[model samples]
Target: MTLGRTSTVPLADLVRRPELGLVVLAGADRLDRPIRWAHVSELRDPVPYLLGGELLLTAGVNFPEDVDGYVRGLVAAGVQALGFGVTPVYDEVPASLVDACVRQGLPLVALPATTPFLAVSQAVGVALAAAEHAELRWLSEAQAALTRAALRPNPLPTLVTALADLSDWWCALLDDAVVAKAGIEEIDPVVVHMARRLRAVSGRRSGSTEVGSWHVVGYPVAAARVLVVGAARPFSVADRAVIAVALALLALADRSDGRSVTKMLLGDDPHEGYRVVRGQRKARGDAEIDLGTGLVDADGDRMRAIVTTVPDVVAAQTAGWLLAVSSPVGVGDLPSADREAARMLERAVAAGRPVTVDDGVSGLVDPEAAARFAATVLAPLATRPELVETLRIWLACNGNWDRTAAELGVHRNSVRHRIGVVARELGVDLADTQRRMELWFALRWSD
Candidate 1:
């Protein structure tokens, strides 16, 4: 209910009420059309001051003959309803005016002979004010309802119900599967948009959006995500605000552990998680590990990183030395928290004791750790300049002598010989996929 930025009274409700005094009333079908209200003054060209929806009042000062041109002019001006004021100059509601209105089906209202035009104007003004008040009240109630729903013990249920109520349509919460939560009997395409946004936002760290006519607010929920979505068929401002509040509440309710990488790297027990390297064993660990510094190719550049995790002797031996990477803390200027974390891991390994690389972020000690260990162990073999390229090509081809030979333009026998030299130097069986994998990483680490 809005009128000229003032309060809005529904035209339907305003018309039905009797105290407003309707000497003649326009039917809703005509009034409901696209209408913008304006007060006009020019008797010669009423259409000029009219922006349509005008209850044009006149004392028949310049009543046109035949009425055809005058009525057509009003229609062309996009007038939704007409109000004629009767005075001594025009003592009666003219038969011509009524005939024209009936012919066109353009609603016609007669301002009473006793009633001044001022009274009609005042009534419309009052209706506008009422409409505005109703709009404000609707917004307030909607916000309160959404707020209450957000705090409920089972928030999703409350949210779905709220959305249905707001939109006056059925709603559903869908993950991989659709859960019919509340509102109408079946799912609508509009609600489907809401579900998709909710799922998409679950994986991202931040951000929100408005989709179609509806305002969809998504938040991370425990083991799931949630969205409160709705608006009247096309959605409105009030509905958007309500959904936004619901999303905020859901976010607050369910928080997550930011230490996913740490938990995974630590293995079982944090106390004795890291493996120790001694002489030959240290050489083997080094062969499998890669510190990632300066290993670049035509395709992509490699960034150096250190992964330090809680010590687990068995897990480290099995998984190789852990190195932390892929953190939110980007590799920037040295002496940052991330740089410090890398330093901690390096120091722990250098000290030959299980140590924790805690820089207030998570750690990763997995296949990446094994890659680092392999590189360290194979450093001596890689130093032989002649053998370096040969071993690299062979491993890259997965020890396939023929493919390695073709890539390197060497004979199969020569390729086999170079591979043997690498295997013997690294003290591993090149024929074993597992052993080949270890040597492969060692070569990468050395690079």
Candidate 2:
């Protein structure tokens, strides 16, 4: 029932049609209001079925005794204008109905005896069809303009500007350290708060919140990146469709840029495989020299390099640089490799040596595989958080009852009871070293 802006026909235009023989009886200044549809209802109270922007045609067959209340109800239901058809029951609009409509500022149109209600309905339908066709053309042009903007050298700013113009709202792209904005110099603090909340919940793709007179909507485009738009009114169907297109374009632009960097840093053939090398250095120069590439990215005090292979000798000989090498992985798996490399780098810094994914005791570096395995093994205690925590603590303490009890602030007997329960639930022998090792690996990998 929601009509697009371009699909709406003004009441004044409908009344101007000569064949309808329509006469404006009241609220002449309100004739420009948009009419979405025409409905002929004889029911005394049909407000529940109306969705606004309606030109309700009634012949006064079941006219309500409380004329003022009836006109007020129509106005409240968002009926654009009331059309009184001249039927045998009421040859003309009643004086009471006219007075009520005039008081309520609801437009009233009188239909002649010669003009069938069907004629007015057909007129409105034809206007709507024409408007819809025009709207489609405009949308197509706007999409083309946005697409062109996305292909520019620096597309982020261009995209923001184009989206702002298209939506008639302020648009911003928020990253961790920088914000790109258009149609506004400074972002409202309320919008910034909403963006932060949206980022905290990663699984949410899009959301809307109200700030004063503005309605803010945010959509996640990448990890730690969001596109936000603020407007005075709620977004219509056309606006949302355009936003979806913009999101897709933005994602493509980001990936395209990232792929170029990946090729330049690693190699032209990414699928051939690569290893992410990380080093702790105050400056990025030393790590870049050791890694044989100036394409190293500095994250705070750590430098990361994506290369075809690991330089073990350089890693071992470097003085202040602690190094870690990820297991060989294709370009598509680089995100996983980057995460594993970060963990390995932490362990290397702790042990004062280079570490690799294989250095771990378990072959569960692949996060998805590890999660599935853990879920399968721990299915019995999945719904029992306290029991899961007790088992994990007991495992961490090397299955020592006294240590686990001290860590958990519980009695030794309680630890013993929980361990017994876990053993029974898992159907495993905690006394066997091999079974204990397997469980320990599952716990570590799952974390």
Candidate 3:
């Protein structure tokens, strides 16, 4: 069973045990309250000697003069429930005590003549210990999960999501700004303010608080940054320990050197699929794409990068900067991926939109042999840019004279003349369907 952090045993756990034979006499509705511990007390006023949430057991040997005031004091001390031993106190629960308990909404349990007070205490102690052990096991699993999450390509989001799942609550990160989160859309403003305040301090600071319905913890993991995690209930000892492990992991994550991380991501685990991205810096922006220089290599007006998968956009697009992504490849073949991305970039520039390489006739044959075939067929028009472009546009238009002419921004007669010249120069028949298809494949590879 999936168990969360628990420090106390619920009163209902003991009441439902058939062996205990404990009967709820008054305030039965309050049995769900948490019991910190079970204590046997007979003094008239035990409030000063007691802590909250204890099952205060009594035989009423030294009964108080004022029963109503006594019950009120117990309630004020936050007693989980009052247990009265029947024979030792009276034949049954005293009417005065029961009436006072019912009036003040204090749960009163009748300990039968058979069950000793020590047995009830022992049951509670065992339950509390079992809960503690289960929580420790849960915490150990949580720490391992966080470590695995830190190994992901996008660790911040992955780690945040893991923490949320572990605590059954929401988590967010603040890096001079609220950067990432999971399991929630909005956090309490008070919690956020506290986190931001924690960020301004130094010396590995951390804090927690009760805000409205939430219990929030702020971990100042990095300089000017904080990781804020919260749940509806108070955090237990084990829960706080798990949070501490997360903070240390995040600190290491912040200390990650970009260059080394990029290197680690690239060559290691190469057999698994990886993609290369090519971006042509056509426009300038305040933000430049920086997945790190090792991952992204800049050459002239273009840059190439390797990633685990494609993203919607590479950081900031910088406006009109074209991007083309290559098909997946491994480490040994990674160098060739740059060339593939370059070809895709040319295609993107031609189509005026982003382009990604996909399986076509190119996949049917060895790429080197296909390139040789394209080079041989289009060798005649290698020096002739006009014929190559005209053929490309004409074929794209499905041999429509007017459409190709409009797209090429040239007259139909000029387009026709250029096609005839291309046919003659390449020594191919334009009317043959097979010939056109072969030439189309060749031209695509040439581009």
Best by TM-score: 3
Model 3 residue 416 distance off true place after TM-score fit, in angstroms: 74
- lDDT tens digits, residue span 130-189, model 3: 877887788788888888667544667778898999967889988756778998887777
Cα distance off (Å), candidate 1, residue 408: 99
Worst 10 residues of 2 by lDDT: 286-295
TM-score of each: 0.42, 0.54, 0.59
Give the poorly placed runs of model 2, Cα more than 4 Å off.
Answer: 1-7, 16-21, 48-51, 87-91, 176-178, 261-447
Report the alpha-carbon TM-score of model 1 versus the true structure. 0.42
Q: In candidate 1, where is summed lDDT lowest over 10 consecutive residues?
A: 293-302
C-alpha lDDT of candidate 1 relative to the true structure: 0.53
The predicted structure with the larger lDDT, 1 or 2, is 2
Query: Model 2 has how many clashing residue pairs?
Result: 0
